[model samples]
Target: MSSRASAPTPPPSSPDTGALPMVQPAPSGSSPQGLALGLSAYVIWGLVLPLYVTALAPAGAVEIVVVRIGFSLLFCLVLLAVLRRLGELREALRTPSRWGATALASGLIAVNWLLYALSVVSGNVLQASLGYFMNPLVNVLLGVLLLGERLRRAQWAAVTLAAVAVLGMTVALGAVPWLSLGLAFSFGLYGLVKKRLPTPGHPVTGMTAETLVLTPVFVVGTVLLHGAGQLTTLTEGAGHFWLMAASGVLTAGPLILFSAAARHLSLTTLGLMQYVAPLGQFLVAVLVLGEHMAPARWAGFALIWASLALFTLDQARQARLRRRARRALTGSQAHA
Candidate 1:
């Protein structure tokens, strides 16, 4: 999942969505502590996660996803109890509308996790990286389509460039990049649903509610897998079992770090840092995994990178303009 920032008060950062709640503006400057936390989180998400997924060898993607959800719920419950915030989880469950929304978000994130796990296990980490790289643009497009948000000229141009890049890849590969698109759209929609939540509970509480909503289904599925002798957790040896169990901490730890980072860094800094995960994935795919990138594929990635450049430049420019306006207003008031 990617860490994203929004206008005004950011939402609480979720494990999957990573958006800070929109209750207050983030700090305008970056602190060393925030940078360290943000970098650690992104690195783990980008570099460590694929390796971790690969390490879960004999286990299939479905089984891995099931275990991840089960363990993640346990982790969230422990976190809530320690923080004395179990009441928040209960309140969310008590409200029908909140529960329903959490359920929908739960489903979306489950799909995202399954897809990501499948990609990593199948050695398609490059495509997974591309999907995340495209995610911010996807968010922008979704905002325009679903939220009636307007895109500035540069943003429109950047989106058009991304579209062309996708078209080029499709033509070169002789098929759609379904894995890439699937990851992008699934997580994008997950973020959208979280944004539309009725109350926007604390990230940990929200995660608990989401996992609680899905726990029964996953538990039943786990039992069925074990009945068929497909479950690998116990049979995979103590090492693998422990690794599988560690999924919960891996899932929630980075998110908490990211949420803390958001409190100390500006959105612009966070926006730039968000790319660290995808870039790490890309490096891992090429350098570590030795995935061959054909000339056409390289060209496509170049175009996408160029599009991101335009998008980032435009955002920085807009932020500068806003800051200047604010400064001018302050100066005029002081003179009066």
Candidate 2:
């Protein structure tokens, strides 16, 4: 064997269409079994939050985002080079409309990244996690409205519950959970846009392009600001600086895994797995990080979980029904 550690096996790619007559299998091959096996990236994400708040030089959210974007770009570029995926990147960028869409998603990711960093540093990883928990519903809604996909009744109930939870959070905060909601909505919408791209670059390479696009501007801005003695937070210490670079690696690693998962799993299963990251964060905040959630916050969490539970059950029922229907159709075809 080669000395180097093997790169993690990516989640399998989106599978072919459902063959059964009654089942409408997802365009993406999302398997619940594979989910448990392939989804460690979220756990990595959960651990990284505490590391995030504790490190990162001056530790402001904006600068964290800047460093994350810079380093993630570097990490992603390396992966792309190793895999030779630049042809895919060029193909994605070749179309004008797709190029514009990529640009839009990139901008939204920047906003989402900054908000998430702020939420973590400001002692609200729980809130950020909930926001992500809310994302699948938003994605489902997008499918209904934008993609014209038909959703089942149980899925509808899940969406309704999620909306209620958002309202509950707003009432508790005496303000909209803007940070959480914004992150959820923007990232969710980013996925929707990518879904439409005829050839969306692999998330890893796509994200790298975003950073590369912004890097020149970011460098120029940094130089100008530092020249005026305005950028003092760049290097507080060796420890903080290295931690800052690690954020970039952290950012892209999960996306690479998720893209792999996206290929092998259905959107519904992916949505449920998405909860793993935030739920871990919630536990860590309460049990490890020692953050507290008041009653209302706890209630908000309950509502979100209830919504997700309904969503998962609904998906399971659908899968079962489809399997039965497939068997029936096979028998009928044999008789003929």
Candidate 3:
């Protein structure tokens, strides 16, 4: 449902927002609650997010992002209060090391949100969907280069094919799809930074900290725009004003559900579930938005999907082996 940015194949400690920390297998008696949570979260992210952004007609991307950050902070604070996690937030603020990390993450996530909102408003939802589809693989590459993680041969092939797909699309479009690249790399990097941070505490608290760092920018931008009469929410109507104000809940709600779902689902199931968002996005772009999908773009999507299939299969295989090994160890210990 979310990336907050996806973790590498093992399903990061969390889906993207918080560190779920304990990823179980799909077969541990799947819960209806998990399924519902995962589906709801993804649907909101995939279907609702685009529609929401598109509905904010004539609002510039910067304006929307600014509003989103401000509201998201408010939403997180409220949730933290309800959850009694304000202490966690205070702890994060007290730590200087976390400030820099959260700041970088805030910047990356801001860029991701800005580009995503822009893509939807501009009817470039296809590019946005493709960018997210490309993100996990991008994380793979980041892991290899930045985290010194080794990838299996299949993983390498997947990464290479992803590059080829992007190259093919660029050749076909006759220009680099900067929007897609911008979304992919920025979110990928955000996940990378979040992975390095201390995860023993609440994830929403971490997100709240990042948004706190970003609040000043939004505050200033809001003031400047309002002073210049460029902020249009007041003129828009009560409904529009409420929608803008609801940005925080929209941002954090799915994430909270996702973290709950993580408690019930396996890494494999959650991994598969994550696809719902982009697929929803892709469908919305084609069916509702009526965005053009040329033959080359289709071909590019085909390549990316094929690469993802290979990558997913490889991860599944590795997970199976790991499970078997643990089972064997347990059996031997029993004999002893």
Best by lDDT: 1
- In order, candidate lDDTs are 0.81, 0.64, 0.79
In the predicted model 3, the residue pairs found to clash are 72-248
lDDT of 2 by residue, 59-92 (tens): 6766666666667777767888899997766776
Judged by whole-model lDDT over C-alpha atoms, candidate 3 comes out at 0.79
Order the candidate numbers by lDDT, best to worst.
1, 3, 2
- Superior candidate under TM-score, 1 versus 2: 1
TM-scores, all models, native as reference: 0.93, 0.81, 0.92
- Give the alpha carbon lDDT tens digit for every residue of 51-79 in model 1: 88989999999998899889989998999
The reply for model 2, stretches above 4 Å from the true place, is 1-37, 148-150, 199-201, 224-234, 258-271
RMSD to native, candidate 3: 4.4
lDDT of 2 at 84: 91
